[model samples]
Target: MKTLWDYTIVLQPDNNGTFVAYVPAIDGCHAWGETPEAAQSELENVFEMIRDEYIEAGQALPDNVELVASHAR
Candidate 1:
C-alpha cells in the first residue's frame, strides 16, 4: 500500500508575469506557468518526481500536510 501526502498548493504571481505554483510542505516543489491551471499542472509533475525520489531514498514523505480537494483535479 502507498501512503499519499496531502498538501495545499499556493499560487502566486511571478515577477516575470507568469504564475508560480508550489506546495509549502515540499521544498523546491514549484513551477511557473502562463496561467493558474498550467502552473498547477506543472506542480503535479514536480510533486510526483519528488515523491519518487523520497521513496527511492527509503524515506517516508510527509502525510496529511493539509486539506485535500474533495473532487478530482
Candidate 2:
C-alpha cells in the first residue's frame, strides 16, 4: 500500500535550453531536464523521495497539495 501525495510542480525553461522543475510546497525539491516531460518525470521522482522522508519522520504533508489532472500538461 503506497500513500499518494499530491504535489504541484512548476516547469520552466532555462536559458541553456534545459527545463527546470520544482515543487513550491517542498523546499529543495527540484530537478532539470532537456524537455518538459523529462523535467516533470524528475520532479515526480524528487517528490517520492520527499514523501518517503516525511513518512519516515512521521510528519504530515502540506495541506494544500492536491493531485492535479494528469492531462493538464
Task: Point to the candidate with the largest TM-score.
Answer: 1
lDDT of model number 1: 0.80
TM-score of decoy 2: 0.74
lDDT of 2 by residue, 1-73 (tens): 2332355667899899999998777787888999998988887787789888888999877754554557654
RMSD of each: 6.7, 5.7
Considering summed lDDT, which 10 consecutive residues are worst modelled in model 2? 1-10
Clashing pairs in 1: none
Least well predicted 10-residue stretch by lDDT in candidate 1: 1-10
TM-score, one value per model: 0.77, 0.74
Give per-residue lDDT, candidate 1, residue 60: 81
Give the clash count for model 1. Answer: 0
> How close to the true structure is residue 47 of candidate 2, measured as C-alpha lDDT?
76
Error of 1 at 45 (Å): 0.4
Candidate 1 lDDT tens digits, 10-43: 8989999899998777788899899998998898
